[model samples]
Target: MRRVLAALAAGAFLVTASACGSSGDSTGSDKASSSGGTTKVKVGVIPIVDVAPLYLGQEKGFFKKQGLELEVSLAQGGAAIVPAVASGQYQFGFSNSTSLMIAQSNNVPVKVVSNGIASTGVQGKDFGALTVKGDSSIKSADQVEGKKVAINTLKNINETAVRESVRKAGGDPDKVKFVELAFDQMPAALDSGQIDAAMVVEPALATVKSQGAREIASPLVDVAPDLTVAMYFTSTSYEQRNAAVVKRFQAAVAESLAYADAHPDEARQIVTTYTKIPAAVLAKVTLPAWPAEPDRASLDALQKLGQDDGLFKTAPDLDKLLP
Candidate 1:
C-alpha cells in the first residue's frame, strides 16, 4: 500500500502516485480487437477489498452485458495504471482517489466513472489499521511520536489516513519517521523492533495481529466518515468515445454492486478465486459496502487531501474526473 510502482498483489500490494515512462497519449484505445460489436478492454486491478465490486461485476457478467470483453490484469501500482490506461494497454483501472488526484495534476485523461466502496461506520472496519507489536510499549497514537512508522506506500491512502488518524488522536504526525515496507513484512518488522507502528490493510491486518501485533487504531472508516476509499476510473477519452458502452457497463455494475452488498459471503467467495489469500483469512477480513454510485463530496475531499499533502499541485477538475 510501499509507495512503489510495482508490487505483489495480495502480499505487499503497493499503490503509489509515481509516474511510469511509457509512450502514449492520454487517449485510450483498446489494444486487442473484438469480433463484431464486442469491445475488448484491458482493465488494471489490484487484489484488495476495494476492488471487490469489480469481482462482482465480472462474476455477474456485467462487462458482457455492456458488450465489453474485459481482460482484467493486476497493476504494479496505481502509478503504473495512468500509462497503462492512457496507452490503451488498459481501457480502465481500479485505483483509489489518492493516486487519481496525483495523476490529474500531470494532465492524465482519466475520470472516476463509478464508486467502488465507501467507508460506512463499522462496515469498513477491516479496510485499514495501524498496528504495533503486541508486546511493544506503544499502546496508543501518542506513543508513536518520534517513533518509526511503516506504511505500504508513502503519500498514498495508507499514510494519509494514518497521518489524519494520528492528528485526531492528539499526536504530531510530523514527529514520526516514515518508512516504506510491504504489507507482509510489517509483522516481522514490528516483532524485530524495526518499526513502532505500521499502517496495513486486509488479511495482513489480521495476519499481523495473529503475529502478536495490536491495533492501536484504524482509519478505515473512523478517520473520515463515508469516505470514497475505492473507485473504478477510465480515461476521459474512453468515456467520451464509448459513451453508450460506458453507460451499459455502469448500469450492470450497479446491479452487481447491490447484489454483492446483499450477499457478502457470496461476493467473498468469488473474490477468492482470483486472489492468493486463503478463504479462512478472507472470511474474517472486513469487506466494504459496494456503493452503486460515486459520492461527490467524498471524492472532492480526497482530491483536496491530495492538494493539501502536496501530492497535487492544483485542484483537479471534478467535472472531468467523476461520472
Candidate 2:
C-alpha cells in the first residue's frame, strides 16, 4: 500500500502533464457521453461501506432522475482512484479528504464536488475506531506508545486520526511504531498478534469487534466532531468543461446522501451488492453520516492537522477545491 501511495504521489505529475495537453475537449466528451437524453459517466470508487450511498442512489433512481448513468469502477483505494480520475479514465472519484488535499497541494488538477462521509462524532459508537485485542495490556490510546500500530495507509487520513488519538490520550505519537495494513487483513493480523492495534472503519470494524477486539478510541471523532472523512471529486479539467454534468452529479449525490442517511437499513443492504461482507457482519456495521453539504469547520480542523503533520506539499486552497 505504501508503494501504491508512492506511485500515486508520483502519478500526480502525470495528471499535471495531461492537464496541460489539448485533450480537455475530447476527455470531457468521453467523460459525459450523451445518448438518448442520458449522460453516461464512469466513477472510480472503493468497495467499502462509505460508498454504499452511491450504490443506493443508483438503485433509488436519483442519478437516473438527473439523466445521468453511472458506470462504477471498483479500486483498491483513493490512491488508485485519484490518478485515474485526473487522467480522465474516470469522470469522478471518491477519496478521503487528506488524499485529495495531498493531490491539490501537489498541483494535481482535482476539485471536490460533494460530501461523501463523516464521523458520527460519538466515541465508541462511530463507524471507525482504534482497537486492540481483547486481552491486550493497552487499554487506551496513550498505552500505544512504543507499540506496533496499523493503519491502512501511512501518512494518510487514518494515520492522522491515530496520531491525534495518541496525542489526545497524552501519548507521544512519534514514539508509536506505525505499520501499513489493509482493512480486510487487519482482523487476522490483530488476532494473531501481528500488530498491537489497528485503526479501522466498517464493516472491518465490525469484523474486528466480532473477534473480540477492544475499542480504545474513535480516532476520527477525536480529530473533530463530524469530521468530513471523504468526498466525491472530479478532475479540474473535467469540472471546467462539464459544468452542467458536474452540477447534475452534485445534486444527484446530495439527494443520494440524504436518502441513505435517512434510511440506514437501505444503506446496509446496498453494501451487499458491491462487497462480500457477510449478512451477520453487515448487520453489525456502523454507517457513517452522509450530509449533503461538506462541513467546512471540520475540514478546517482536519487541514490544520494535516499541515502540522506535513502531509501536504503546500496547504490546499479550500476556496478553489470546494464546490
Candidate 3:
C-alpha cells in the first residue's frame, strides 16, 4: 500500500506558492434562492491540481447557478477533513477516499457526494510517481525495505499506496521507516541522502525526476484501478437537510468537471489563483479526469483496503455514507 497524505496538523494551511489573489465574492445575494433556498457550504481543499474541477466551479460561477454559496477553506489534508465535514464545520469538501473510508468505518456520518479525479491510464496525467535519488542504490520497491522513506504524512494516501506497492514488490512494508516531510523538503532530503525515497505528486514529482531521482513506481489509476484519488463530500446530516442543495451542487460540480476536461489550459490557469505552482509547472503536470458520478468500486476498494490494512478498527456501512 502507498502512503496516504491525509493527516491534519497545526500548520496545515501552508501558503500556496502561486496564489494570485482571493477569488472575488461569488454570492448571488440579490437573486432569489433556488428550490431549497440559500445554502452555504464551506468546502475544504488542498491547493493542488487534483481538485481542479472545484476551482473551476468557483471561478466559473457553477456554485452560484446551484444557489450555493461556496466558501473554499484551506484544509490541512484529507485526514482531518473528515472531522471538519462530519461535525458540520465544513458543509462540503474535497478529500481522498481512504480517509473517508476509515471515517465512515468509525461512524463519522459522511458520504462521497461526487467523484473528482479518476485514473485514465495517463502517466503524470492521472497519477503520481515515486522517486529515489538517482545515484542511490535503491531502484525498486523491494529495495525500500529497512530504509527510511519520506511521505507527506503517515496513514494518508501516499503511505497507503507505497506500502501496497512495496508488498507487491516483495518487500515487507513494516520494515521500512517512515518520516513525514513537506513536498518542498523532499528534494533537499534526497540531496542530503536523509531519506531513501519520497512518494511525490506533480509538479514536485517532475521536479524530483529532473533532479535525477530514479523512478521507482507510478501510483494512480494503474496502481489502484478502482481507487478514487480525488472526491467531493459532505456530511450525512447536511445532505439530509439540504438534499436539493446537494444535488444542485453536484450538478454544478459535474459541469465544472466537464468544462475542465474541455479546457485544460483554463483549468490550469484557475488553479493558479490558489496554488503556488507557476504556469510552466502546470504545463508539464498531467491532470486527472473529473468523473460525473462517484466510483462505487473505488469506494469499496478503499473500504476493504482500510480494513485489511488496519487503517481503521471498524468498517462503517459505506452504503449509508453515499449521497
Candidate 4:
C-alpha cells in the first residue's frame, strides 16, 4: 500500500495539524500576540515522515505557545507550494531545498524559515537510499553505471544525491539513466526489472527494504550527511511584515525538534497519528534528524549540486533563504 505521505503528496486534501483554539502559554508571552490575539498561518505540507516535527509541534502546543495556528494545507508537491506562498495564499510552506532554490532562481522570493528533516548519516539509518533487488548482482554505486535508475522525480534531490553517490563510488554519473516512478511503484519496478535500481525515501525505503530489497548506497548521506531534506518557508514580504511572528514560529519549531530528538518513542507515535503508517512498519522506520536550524554546509552543497547539474543558471544566494 502507498504511504499516506505519498497519497497526500499527490493532491489528497488539507488537514489542520493544530486543534481548536486553545489558551495561550500563560507563563510566557505570545510573540504573535502583536497580530492581535492569535495568528492563523496556513502552510502547504506533504504528509511525509520528514514533516513529523510540524505535527509534533501542534501536539506539544509549541505553536500555540507562540499564539500561531499552523494549518497544514496539503499540496501535491513543492511545485504547487511555491506559487501558493508566492501568491500570498499561504503564509508558509514545507518544500525540499532544491524546489525552493528553483523558485528563488526564478525570483519567487520564498525564504526558508527553519530546518526540517536531516539525514541520519549512519548507513541503514537514513530515510533515503539507492537500493536494488535482493538477488541483483549490483553491489555498489559503481555497478549502477550504465544502468537505469528510478527516482521519484528527475532533476531533484533524489537524482542529485544519487549522482553524487555515483561520482563518489568512482563511477561516471553521466553513464546512468534516470526514470521517474512513484515511490510505492518503485519496488515492484525493481522486482520486475523495469528499473535496475531506485533512489527512494522513507516509508517507501522501509517498504522496499522489507520486501527484500538491499541498499547499496545512502546517497543523501554519502553526498552530505545530516542533509536537510526540506524546510518551512514563506515569502520575503511575509517575513518582513511578521518578523516577530516568524521568530516565534521558528522558536516553536526548534523546540519541537529538540523535543522529538529527546522523545523518540512519542515522536514515532505522533508520526503514526498523522501519517497512519502501519504499526509494524512504523516501529521499523528510520526517523530523520531534526536540527534546530538548517545546516549551512549542507545547503551550500545542495545548491552547488544543482548548479553542477545545470538545474540553476547560477548558484542561489543561500543566506537569503535562511531565517
Candidate 5:
C-alpha cells in the first residue's frame, strides 16, 4: 500500500508540475467527441457499492437522456483517480471528499460536480464500520490502541473517521497503529489475524460480518450524521471549458443518485455488473445514502476532523471546490 501511495504521489507531483503547460482549450469542442449528437466521455471510478448509482444510471439511460455516453474505467482507489482527472486522462472521476480536498489543497485543480455517497447516520447499521474478529477481546474503538488496525488509505477519510471514533471512544488515536490495506483484502487479513482490526465499507464489510467479524464502531457515522463521504468531480479545466457538458452530467448524476436511493434492489443488482461481490454477501451488504446533493454541514464536519488529524496541508476552499 505504501508503494501504491508513493506511485500516486509521484503522479500527483507530475500533474502539479505540468499544470502551467496545459492548452486550456474548451473540452466540449476539443476533448469530448460527439457522435450522432451524443457526447462520449470517460469517467474513472472505483468498483465499489458506493458507485452502484453510476452503473444504475447508465442502465436506466440517465446519461443517454442527457446526450452523454459514459465510458466507465475502474481504478484501485480515489488517490489514483484524482490525478488522472486533473491530468484529463478522464473527463471526470469519483473520489472520497477528503482525497479531493487534499488534491485541491495541493493545487491539483479539481472541482466537485456531484455528490457520490453518504453515511446512513445509524451506528452499527451504516455502510462503513471499524471491525474486529468476532471472538477478539477488542470490543470498541478505544480498545484498538497500540493495536494494528488496517484502513484502505492512510491520512485519508477513513483514517480521519477512525481516529475520531477512537477519540470519541476515549482512547488516544495516536497510540493506535494504522496499517494501509485494501478493503477487499481486509476480511481475509482480519480472519488470518494478520491485522487486529479493519475499517471497511460495503461488500467488504458484509464479507467481514459473514466471517463473524463484529462492528466496533461506525466511523463514518461518527464523523457526522449523513456525512458526505465521496463525490464525483472533474478537472477545473474541464468544468470551465465544458460548462454545458458539466451541467448535463450534474443533472444526470443527480437523477441517478435519487433513483438509486429510491430503488435499492435495482442498485444491488447493478453492483453485480461492476464488482465481484457474491450474491448472498451483496444481499446482506448495507447500502449507503446516495444523496442527490452533498450535505455542506457534513462536509464542514469532515473538513474540521481532517484538519484536526493533519490530513490537509492547507484548508481546502469549499466555496470554490463545490459545484
Candidate 6:
C-alpha cells in the first residue's frame, strides 16, 4: 500500500479510497484497435500488489504474444477507472467487486473479464489483515467493539470484510467506527492511536508488522474466505465489439499469472517499476493470491456482502459479468 494507490474517494457511508500515480481522465487515445493490426487499449489499475500479474504480463511480453499493446494507467481505486473505461478511454480496468457491481447497478458499461486477486487466509499468504499495535488492548475481534479502525476505503472490500470479521469474532460491527486512510498512512495512524486498528493489504501490512504490529484478525480469510479481492475488467461495449481481442487479452493475463506464480522474486522485482516502494521494502512486502483466471463463485460471495450493505439494489448480472 505504500507504493500502491488508493485512488478514488467515495463519499459518506460508502466512502473508500486507495493511491493514484495520476488521475485516469479522458485525455488519451482510446483507439480500441488498430487498422495496422495490434489491439491497443489503455488499462486502468490500482497500484496494489493485486494487479501485479498485469504488469508481469507486460514485462513478459504476454500481451505482445496476443497481438495486444496494453497501456497501464494507475488510479487510486476502481471508482476512478470506471468512468475512464465507461467513456472508452480505458478498454480494460482493475477494480474490487463491490465497486464494479455498484457501478453496473447504476448501468455502467464495464464487465469483468478475469478475477484479479483472492484471499489466502494464512499468515504469509494472507494479503490483508486487521492489525493493531503490539501492546494494544484489542486482542480479539470482539474487542474491536467501540474501537476506531482504519481502512483503505470506507465501504469497499476491506471495510466490509473487517466488519464481517468483527461480527464473526463476536463483536457488534455497527459499534465500530471506520475511518478512511491510505494504506501506507495506516501504520502511523495506528502507532499514534489515531486509529485503534487498521484493515490493511500487503506490503503496507507487511511493513506495519515489521514495526511490531500484531494481527487482530485476517479479515479477508476470516470473514470472506477466498473472496475475490479485485478483478480485470473492461467496458461491456468493448467486449461486445471486440470479443476476440478481449479473449486474447484474458489469455495473456492468465499466462502472466502463471509467470508470477512460478517466478515470484522476478515478478516482485518487476513491481518496483510500477510502485514507488523502496527496493528493500518491496522485497519484504506480502503479496496476495493472484489467480490465473477469474472466479465467479468468489466474486458472488463478495457481491453478496456488498449487496447486503445496500451496495446494489439488484443482484449483479453475474452472467453478463463473466468474461
Task: Look at candidate 4 and tell me the lDDT of residue 90.
Answer: 67
TM-score, model 5 to reference: 0.91
Clashing pairs in 5: none
Clashes by residue pair, model 2:
none
Clashes (backbone N, CA, C under 3 Å), per candidate, total: 5, 0, 27, 0, 0, 15
What's the lDDT for residue 126 in model 2?
A: 98
Comparing 1 and 6 on TM-score, the stronger one:
6
Point out the worst 10-residue segment of candidate 3 by lDDT: 1-10
- Residue 55 in candidate 2, Cα distance off native in Å: 0.4
Off by over 4 Å in 4: 1-36
Give the clashing pairs for model 4: none
Query: What digit string (tens of lDDT, one per residue) describes model 1 on residues 1-323?
Result: 12222231223222322222232432335444568888776677765666766777777787777777876776434655655665556777877767777666667667887777777546226557888888888877767888999986667776777776777789887787888876666768888899888987765676676677788877655446678777778777778887776676677667778888998888777767765666667767776667777777776766665666677657777776777
* TM-score between model 3 and native: 0.83
User: Superposing every Cα of model 5 onto the true structure, what RMSD results?
Assistant: 5.1
The CA-based lDDT of model 6 is what?
0.74
Candidate 2 has its poorest 10 consecutive residues by lDDT at 15-24
Give the TM-score comparing model 1 with the true structure, all chains together.
0.83
Report the lDDT of model 5 for residue 135.
Answer: 94
lDDT string for model 2 (30-116, tens) is 357789999999887777799999999999999999999998876656766787787677899899999888888877888999999
TM-score of each model, in listed order: 0.83, 0.90, 0.83, 0.83, 0.91, 0.87
Instruction: Report the candidate with higher lDDT, 1 versus 4.
Output: 4
Report the lDDT tens digits of candidate 3 across residue range 166-217.
Answer: 8777888889888887665787788789998988765566567667787787
The regions of model 6 sitting more than 4 angstroms off are: 1-30, 33-36, 123-125
What is the lDDT for 26 in model 4?
18
When 4 and 6 are scored with TM-score, the better candidate is: 6
